[model samples]
Target: MTELEYTTFGKTGLKVSKLGLGGAPLAGDFGITDEQEVQRMIHAAIDGGINFIDTAPLYGNGESERRIGQAIVDRRDRVVLATKAARSDMRYDYETTIRSVEMSLHRLQTDWIDILQIHDVESQPYELVVSETIPALEKLRQDGKIRFLGVTTRNLELLRKYMATEMFDSIQFYTRYMLLDHTAKDETIPLAKELNMGVINGSVLGMGILADAPAPFLREDIQADGLARMEQLAFLRKPGPKGLIEPAMRFSLGNPDVHVTLTGVSTLAALQTNMSYCDGNGLASEEVEKVYALFQEQPLFD
Candidate 1:
């Protein structure tokens, strides 16, 4: 087991594990129907020394939180619980956000949430946050229901817009070590460090793009070309022995502002493999540089 190093979340200096287990896919992405197996994997992560575990209400519509609560029922104090609240149809106002957080606590079977994020609200109207959500989150903090408030969005613009407010302790977005892109390190990372907000990198494996090479998300009856890009990255990336995923995981963690990188991996073996990067034998500088160059060489054309 690796000795997980802790870092400051924002200026709080509240230590959190560098590698966090993303509790999204564990809900149903891998077709894990057995509760006992899911619980075992969650325990395996905890036993392996992961202090931070992140989940969301939208993940299987709250199934992820339920399973996580079950697994950590006995040792709730050991986990730094984080969850998000977001609804697409009508914007979730302050009261709804509060209700959602409380619901997540009930589902997670924990008294207090360590981190509560405004999930996916980066794309929504800004007034919704200032008018409704932030106030509610502040009230929750006052009431001792949550320890910290943050935002998770895939947009860099949204982060920039909210950065000036000092309303959030952390900002999350999709960042990875894959050859396909290094946008996080080049653009958003510097700003996050400048703002002193902990940058959490989700999709650290490009949503499992680099995790498996020979095998991929293939349908049973027919085929699709969704994997063409993945195969190209696997074939093109240089100076690394791992497939697109593992090397990328190491590369993302190499960033300084990145306090924790979320790997949405399921099962004990997969968790062990991801944690090996923090064991001090991760991707070499030369290897990461190669991937970075590839992204620089081929910026996505918008």
Candidate 2:
């Protein structure tokens, strides 16, 4: 196996693998997942030099964290584990925020989480998040339950709002930085760099659209627009199954502004394919310029 590259995780100072394992697929959300198989994949990820794992209680109602907890119990020290608060079932109040992390800790079977993020902030009122939710996370940090604070949202404007708060050490957004969009480069990513926050780029494959297995729930307009945009870049696809997969993964993995490019894979083969792009490779200069120019300041998903 090739050695994966590492980077300093923004202001947090922890070194993380450029390719982080995302826990959504392990929750069986994408398909039926075998617990033992999931454990093996997690171990494989650790063995392949992947030290960053991102999960959330919202992923299969805590199933992702539970499986990861079981897999990493003996090797917990080997990775930089991250999970989120604010499940879809609960309100994002201070009490709920505290309870969420507590439940996550129980499910993850860990005393401390490396990074605890406020999940999907775009769904709630910003004032509520500022006055109540963030304080709860702060309390968790002060109590030594979580090391750093972070936020995840697909809304660029809302993401910029959170970044301007300067309270978080990291920010995660998906789809915006992929081959189909690349809008994060317009502002959110640069702002994150200005804030010295770690940037975790998720859904580099556009929730499977780049791989020809587009998520069923994607808005018709997003799917249509993305597919249309993807069509113009037929030249970038490889010669294998869903040729866009490799380029999609490498597009983000090769980015200098992105600290961790998450590959949310359920199968070992998919993990290996994503890991293969960590060898310090990116698109050619001309190709990169073309992709960037294709959607300059154009938001794909509102």
Regions of model 1 farther than 4 Å from truth? 175-178, 213-242, 297-302
lDDT by candidate, in order shown: 0.73, 0.90
**Candidate 1 on 1-302: residue-level lDDT in tens?**
66766677777567778888898877885556566777887888888888889998888888999999989999888888888875554477977888898899899998899888888875568898888889998998999999888887766667777877888888887633244556667667787788788778887655444554322454422122324445645543545555565566667666657888887866777778788776534567776665566546232311
**Which candidate should be chosen as best, given lDDT against the real structure?**
2
Model 2 lDDT per residue over 169-228, tens place: 999998889988888897888898888899999989888889998898889998898889
Alpha-carbon shift of residue 185 in model 2 (angstroms): 0.3
Task: Return the TM-score for each candidate structure.
Answer: 0.87, 0.98
Clash counts for all predictions: 1, 0
